[model samples]
Target: MNYEKYYPIVYKQLYYLVGNNELAEDLTQEVFIKYYNSKEQIEFLGAWLSKVAANIAFNYLRGEKRRIKREENILEEVNNIFSIEDEIFRSEQIKEVRKILVNIPDKQRVCLILKFSGYSYEEIHNATNIPLNNIGQFIARGKQKFVKLYKKEGEINVL
Candidate 1:
């Protein structure tokens, strides 16, 4: 594959989706990395690359939205709290979520996280390299597993 020939095209497409040069550059690099790592031949290389670039950019944007919202929520919580005990309780809540996340398989874990992070099915598929048709199933199964584990552990619902 002629990477140099497609670099600008992919970069420009990513920049249009993300509206940031640095993020576009990073996503463009990620697209090429996927290309390099593919074990099978891509029939329509340019189109495939472009599609992947767009998906990655969209996924990044969705994840960013979730992150910003989470930060805002955390800020609000901190501002409203007056006790150190509350802060420690908040930290414990995060740990509980992490424990559930760890108990799931990689695909299920990623699908759940991406969904919770406000990503569309297409975006989750792109980020995890999972198939579009199976995104929902992965998410559903992930949630079921989390709930089962949560109940078994008897952990307080903090998320």
Candidate 2:
């Protein structure tokens, strides 16, 4: 299997699906493993790989308790060690940002993140299932609200 050739392509696709860097990487690994395990049976390798990645990512999200437990374990390990002042400061700022983000409308925040994350208008429309004309308005409004909140409070509205 030419797994190396497909890794970058599949990883990028999976990133949009999961919205988390680390989880996307893990899903990429799982996708390749599925590919290797069923190499002989797959009639279309690319399609099979994508389907498997999507299914696994969806399953991962469906298992929210497992995700939370995994996060809790990682946090527990880190909390056992000494903490840096910068880490503390960053955590507090993150909390504040989350609070501010909660006040933002959901569509606006999603638009902002997708646009800022380098997605094209067409890509945004496709990913969000929104109309093409509405993409620009959503992004424009989202950015305006974000900038206003940032200037007013000196913090990002992110959650």
**Tens digits of per-residue lDDT for model 2 on 59-115?**
878797688999999997787543666688889988866766666788888887888
Model 1 TM-score, 2 decimals:
0.51
lDDT tens readout by residue for model 1, 95-155:
9889878999999999999899999998887787898999999999999999999887774
Provide the lowest-lDDT 10-residue window in model 2: 150-159
Error (Å) of candidate 2 at residue 100 is: 48
Give the deviation of candidate 1 from the true structure as CA RMSD: 27.1
Per-residue lDDT of 154 in model 2: 65
Candidate maximizing TM-score = 1
- Residue pairs with backbone atoms closer than 3 Å in model 2 (clashes): none
Cα error of candidate 2 at position 149, Å:
55
Over the full model, what C-alpha lDDT does candidate 2 score relative to the true structure?
0.81
| Cα TM-score of candidate 2 | 0.39
Candidate with maximal lDDT: 1
